[model samples]
Target chain A: MTLLAKNITLSYHQYEIINNLDLEINPNEITAIIGPNGCGKSTLLRGLTGLLMPAEGEVTLDGKPLQQWSKKTLAKQIAILPQNPSAPEGLTVKQLVEHGRFAHQGLFSKPTLEDAEVVDWAMQQTSVIDYQARLFNTLSGGERQRAWIALALAQKAKILFLDEPTTFLDIGHQLEVMELLKELNQLHNIGIVMVLHDINQAGNYANRLIAMKQGSIVADGKALEIITSELMKTLFNANTKIINYQHNGHQKSYCIPVGI
Target chain B: MKTRTILRGPKTNKRFYISVFALAITLVLSLFFSQIIGAAKVNITDFYDFFMAPNESAAQKIIGNLRMPRAIIGMFVGAHFAIAGLLLQAVLRNPLADPTIFGVSSGASLAVIASIFLISAIMPTTTFLTSADIPIFYVPFIAFFGALLATFLVFWLSWEDGNVNPKRMALGGVILGSIMTSAVMAIIVGFGQAKAELAIIWMAGSLYGRSYNNLIPLLPWSFICVIATLAIIKPLSVLRFDDDIAQSMGLNVKLWRMVAILISVGFAASAVSVVGPVGFVGLIIPHLAKLLIGGQMFKLIIVSALLGALLIVLGDLIGRSILVPLEVPIGAITSLIGVPIFLIILQKSGWKLK
Candidate 1:
């Protein structure tokens, strides 16, 4: 359950994007990574999830290097959903979710009863159970995203990583996804880490916010402590006013970008 | 009630069983039809007489030696090419991908053509005596290696950074196919008319004179490749998604991709070596299967294998019988029939690759 990135450097095509970045992921909290475009938010997510090998340090899961862990064994602990994943033609939501149990099933063995139960649970958790038999390509943008999340959930992993889960979603759907993630984190106690484009959504939903600039972590702390007009100016070079409110005995914070 | 209804057992959909039943019936009918309806005056009684009676008549010999082996070869060749095409399209994530797209058919053609020229040049006395003059048994073997070599070249050329892009592989296959086609043309023209007629017939693709010699060599290959295809079915289905997504699911995407490609190469090369590159069954039958049974990998493979065999057996039957003394190549027959049916499927299903 301990996933740590120790001085890792990730690069694409010989150019360094994340250099000597060190961070440890908590196994029971929602962590949002907020950064501008090309600031390496997605690259860091890929690096941590074993999708990309770091050029310089190592990513350790339970104090063992990622390479030492077999792909299936590692997959049993960590699941990732890339932005805008495309399914094969004619694949239904249930079929797509069934793929999440791949690491749990043998090469030639049929899916076990547990695997089917997990698939059904994931679909219901994401509220995509109604669309289980529907073609994935025919779903709307929000429903498609939910189906993808359900697929990841069917992996039954302790930690889930998503790259921009709310991109291209309208306001209502964005809130819908964030609320679902919040419920998943609180109720299931699954560790959630996501690279979010909307700073307000990050501040509103994430338990911890890690702000980045040019592939480096600039600030990492609670949303209330790190999300300020000064931090917004540093992260995005925008003039903004921090707005704080109280709702249901919880403190909420968001910043309005007024000028560049 | 909803949970009870949703938690059904692990059986496949009803449509899949129906498709399997329909394909099985057609496959048997096609096999029987291919046996009886050739250019020779053969009938259903000859089928029983050949099996039941020990004294071989002229018609019995024809059925036992010629028609039986040819039909078997036709069925297997069709099945091999269809499954190969399905794997290629799945791995490439392209609807247009087929065995030829990997430089398999054209490369085998070029090798067979070049080797014939070399043999003819080495012995000028037997230069224009047709393929029968040469040791034709080795043609299938030579064509197989040629397919592997061409596929290797295309795969090597398509490699960039750490991964092979499906788009690049498709484009590389196109370029290599054209190069081999031109090379084949140049060799045929430059080498004069020495064995050119035989080479042209092989290139046009026919099951003529194919017998136990061809079927025996392909049997082991079909057994191994088909089993390998089944073994990798799960990864093949996962591979239809983006590479990164597949990898995140704990698949060694690159390794599995290589295995799938190699299995497909085994199928296409063996079948082409036997039948000399029958084209449309590999290209169109998988699409037909996908349209009929949906794109579930296992069901698609099953339906494609049966439909492919059915198409080729029937096509070969019509090819020989329709022309009487003259023979239309099985490849020509398949394309002529496959295109119209493919068009009809397209219009009816409104199938889209995306």
Candidate 2:
């Protein structure tokens, strides 16, 4: 399904955060948005996922305007996991994941077999099946993050959007989450879009990288073409060295911010 | 491969079922014991005779008229307060949220007391207990509007930017409740000495001398709100997650939040209007239920209702029987038991609302 944002402007209480932005999200690629703080990366994600209503333009999924589609139908095509989300105390991983099927089930109807299977599939995919019985509060940060991803996966949405999914995670867990997203995109053809803090992680993992500054896209292209020192200096006012490398027979680039 | 059902929630062992069964039995036993344990010196034979024998004794009259209605009211009020607390906790995403703590009950109490004072003032000759003078049935309805108003006030006070902060909500609720309570007392004092005792007793939340007039107004609210809470269990559970996550999970967070607030306020208002402010049932019963049944919404709601009913009936029974002739208010008993446990829970609780 094609998700398109046409000249959308998002604001909170008349103070605009994203101004007249247009974006087209490919349904089968991993897109990483890299930007500094207060650059509207998260706001744009919310606007595209129907979380934030744009004041100016419209977001459409599969040619239907987001406002016209019922929330459940829109949710069937797109799912979003907000940054640093929390669950209720004593909620177990499985129960938390089962909440993803809310749009699929009737108000009073019990969860069907298909819903249960999908939840299981999601947990298994995230490798959190073993922790299904564990309370969310008791899990390690990485496990909790995976459980949240499982919850999003359980929604069975073709496009998944996450805001800084790797924040508060360790280096290994961060890589684990990035690898999982890449695997989901490659195997399941699920569109993955995330706001990433680490530019190197974004360049290493994402098929397409979108760089932003002051609520506008400054660069949108392949990671190799977009990870130049000039772009880093312009976006973040930081001096950086870019190194080209090869991993698994693929060209990859990682950058390091230099002092002075 | 064994398939897991969401009906059972995340994890259900023998312990959860046993706890629910035990609570249900306790509720039934309390209901029975409440009928015979009051000041009138009645026994099991008296209870059986009241139901079975044709000729009615003085004790049978007491059972039929006084104890029976009181017990029934206690049961419904307990269920109402517990469910109200449960719904409020979920809606606010705060472990400490409840009708009494959040000022919903205080608002209802204010509305009730103000309306009563207005009615009495309009008919200056009419006394407080005169059944013919006052429109008793409209009390719950009036209290509902009052509760809705208070809920709005608290939400408005706690709202920041686009979200609510739990700390601000708790503090705001406390301040609003104190203000409304002082106003209620001022109205009570305005009535002078003759009617003050009855109003005081009612405010203290005694089920003493409550009858069908109180029960009838509360029945529909208790039934409808409980059923409505169950009907929206999915959205209610989803709502406990972060607002953005809840919205993405396909819940219209604002709409469902309003529905939860209304249902919860209905429970608190109906019960408060009928029995004055029965504090702590709405505060502690949901936490007690969570301790027993975990936080799965369906089981938590069901067990909370049962536990609430048990606490109220037992509290009422203890309040009346423990002092023979002099009655301790049910509210007093609940507070005496609740405050200590609440402190302990607070000290040990690890949940956060952000």
Candidate 3:
């Protein structure tokens, strides 16, 4: 259930997006991809999801080339939740989540008992069961984001990719989503690779932090070891103050960027 | 029963019931009134008797041959346009997208006009010495080819680098549709006497000379298109989300999008081939159906199809009877009637495009 991208080079209209990038994701860890704006964080995530083909290099999942795997087969193992996904009007939370079961369903198959069970489980895990009947458009931004996360969970994927999942979310909802990710990683052993805008959140939540600068990995290690002032200054071109604290007996690190 | 239980949701349930009620009322009223109100009015009781057991009366012959076929043709054509419109709206994710917006109707119309009016005139002595003995079945075939060609052109123009951008598709369709319609208009104006009657009939989208032969050829293709649509309802719903999300969920987005376009083209073309380009039914009916029933593609498809059928049948009936001996075009009637209702619904719903 590991994903490996080897020397991946990606470009759009002759402009290089990801240049000779290589990264490896372990089976059971929360890995966060962080970089300054236009530094190819989202581009790398897209490359991993097969949405954008690499100009050169190979992406392998479980030691098999991603291109060789059928779309459905790949989807079964990996689910992606894009930032600010547009939902159809009048779609309920349950209905939206049920769509995640598409890969598992046959051409003529109706939603089976197992499918329902999975959807229900996903909704419960995301704490969206209470709003299962609510129209997606009617929900608040935070709730809506959770509902989309639930949809990804419903896929029952062993690996998940989230593109800036908490960008527009409030601090409370951000923690909620992060905590859910941590629980999912710990309990289900699902590998999570996400693009995060907030360096503090990435430091707090992710087990492994991969910082990209100019389409290449500048730092990739355990969050605490790589989130130092020098690495932050180099990656973001800004001075940063590191604060260490204990939260509910768990050690945590926080970064405050100067001249933000 | 089990499926109904699983499908239960307050909004979905309410919409489903309302759609069922509206469709039932529309179907009955349209069918009953369509048979009764023609050039020569017949009693409702007489119309029923004619259908059950026909007597050798002119009223019976007119009811059986003219009005009934007209209504049936209207329903089919209406359903086709409406469903096509609905699919287009969903696929494009644009509220304003419809069969006409995409130029499928115009493309088909151009093909038909060329085959029916221009081709026959240019090669007058090639096949049959006289136009009277020419096979009537040939008209729809030519129209079908026209529709297919138009759709192919639209697809070619809009598709770029494996992406079918909605805006590009609509723009391409509009340009192509305009050119084709101009050609149709030019042909009609250039050959006034020889093609006037046929052109008028096609424009009005009448059911005057339709036989079982017309319905037979179109039925199978239409059914196939509709069934294909039904099969893809789940994928369409998934597509309603972001394309990246849908792709990650294992959908072959490009292939499915192409299939959807083909279905829309097939149904729209088939309808045009049978009847002329009946406007507004496809544009307005799907929106109305969405209002009555929420945006579940499965339910939306059926309700839109039924509502479309209802609108056209009623519109055709009104056209046939309102002016008595001089029948108005069903296309004109649909636009006149449907546009206002659509606007009213749009106003009520605050024109929210979701």
Candidate 4:
């Protein structure tokens, strides 16, 4: 397994955050963790990245303990960008993207040709190359988020984690970020684990969906199989209707929740 | 497609280039002119003679022993304060944050004040080391401990529910710093003879009469602290993003924050020990540098250091030259010059509080 968690339990003081959670993430797939607010979705991603140690469990990446891996090694294998990343005033996109190469570049060594190439390619892939010289804070929310994604891509990690990448974006920008993630997964076969609030977006784009309620997974399977009306009601405490639609000549399933 | 491609190209290149060029020019001008502006007017020939061949004449003593050391120390201390300010501003994620704003300077000053007043009273016969006569090695050591105690106290008080909120942290620092500053003032007022001279000199922030001996002690410690900051530059840049985002990027947010704070405190402490709380260099230089060069850690460090060095050297020169025979304190000079420039920048930028 590229990443696996066994019997993971986490807590903050007396409140249990994640209780006896177990999961495995395969290579080259888009896995979406869907849940209502405060359902420990972010906490799970934190545990996977070794940011938060589970109270009573272990997370292993490539058969080695996650803690055993050095920060640089983990950084090279996995890149994550969370929601609403803040930058200091006047931070240019190029400079921000250059930070992703930190894990690969040594302290004394300057940026090599290959590092520059990767950074350039990452910017190109995310369509942020044109804004490379612009201050990050000056960009629109969507544009800024794209720059952050470009930074993560510069790491050239095989796996990427995103926490609510589309949170504050308008619908169009939301689609833009989603399309970028889809392209990264399809073109490079990168493993993607993202916490998504919008159930329809998750169902449409994710290969696998894991539904969580009150810090434990209630359903886990292929998107169509796991995102059932019963599961949606249990996970979100709302009645949901699943509908079929044709989008650009492709069949898509959309979920509409009612009576919160 | 063409429009999008063009939009993605380098946007702020012109501004960055101009700022860098300006910073370089200022550094050279400041360093060169500061040497000539001291109390005794030594011409260009005397400056060259002091540099090219030392001990040639007694006039060289005025340039070599006094002005030279003072200028170099000013430059180094200024660089340290500016870099520390940059780090603190980034860590707090607030533009207004500076080294003194976070109580680090006041912390060190309080410790020094206590050492001056209380330590002397406890041991009446023991000799108190003066900055000029004392061996240079011990100065930074005393300053480092004083700084460490103050920052530790700030850190301890600011911790609530296991997370450090930037706003609360700043408030805590301000409250503690004010308390310390008042205490130091009380001690200075209460002690009549032996403590008064040291207290007044430290409060005014003068670079006068500092020797190479005083500079040596601060050099190595400052170098280590600055180098440590360089190591964390990448992480710090990532941290500028929101906390969750930084963590997702595989940065250990809590650990990195602690590391940044520790290094910043060390730099501020060392600078304060030598330069005596030169203000606004820390508060304003980082913002000015950020405005000039975009906030890439690599570029920010270089530009902030250079700009800071330039400011201090200029402040020292103005302090010495403005009144001729009687010197103005370097701190007063810096505040007088820096505040106006800073306000202008703020006005032009149309900075609005978030």
- Per-residue accuracy of model 4 over A98-131 as CA lDDT, tens digit each: 8788778765678899988898899999998877
- DockQ of all candidates, in order? 0.59, 0.60, 0.61, 0.37
lDDT of 1 by residue, B1-354 (tens): 476356332334778898899888988888888778877888788887777874668788888789889999998999999999999988888777888767888888788777767776776644322344456566656777898899889888888878887778888988999899889878877775745666666677789888787687788889999999999989999888888788778788888888998888889888887788788777788888876766688999999999989988889888988879889999899889977876886777566754
Native-to-model Cα distance after best TM-score fit, residue A210 in candidate 4, in Å: 1.7
Clashes of each: 0, 0, 1, 11
The per-residue C-alpha lDDT of model 1 at residue A99 equals 90
* Ten contiguous residues minimizing lDDT sum, candidate 1 chain A: A129-138
Model 3 segments more than 4 A misplaced: B1-11, B14-18, B122-141, B208-211, B344-354
User: Model 4 off-target regions past 4 Å?
Assistant: A246-251, A258-260, B1-25, B31-66, B118-134, B160-165, B192-194, B222-239, B247-259, B320-327, B340-354
Question: Mind giving the per-residue lDDT tens digits that candidate 1 earns over A1-260?
Answer: 79999999999999999999999999899999998899999999999999999999999999999988988888889999998888888777888889988888878999888998999899999999876777778899999999999988988889999999999999999999999999999999889999999988998899899999999999999999999888889889999999899979999987898999
**For residues A73-128, could you state the per-residue lDDT of candidate 3 as single tens digits?**
98989998887888876677788888889999987888899998999889888888
The sequence of per-residue lDDT tens digits that candidate 3 reaches over residues B38-87 is 66758877887896877978778777777777677777888888888887
Please report, as a residue range, the 10-residue window in candidate 3 chain B with the lowest summed lDDT. Answer: B125-134
lDDT, candidate 2, B141-241, per-residue tens: 99999989988898899997666666788889989998999988998898735667888888888787788887987888887997899899989999898
Stretches off by above 4 angstroms in model 1 are B1-12, B119-141, B192-194, B340-354
Cα lDDT of candidate 1 equals 0.85
Better of 2 and 3 by TM-score: 2
RMSD in order of candidates? 2.6, 2.2, 3.1, 3.8
Q: Fnat per model, in the order given?
A: 0.56, 0.69, 0.71, 0.56
| CAPRI docking class of candidate 2 | medium
After the best TM-score superposition of candidate 4, give how far the Cα of residue B141 lies from its true spot, in angstroms: 0.6
DockQ order of candidates, top first: 3, 2, 1, 4
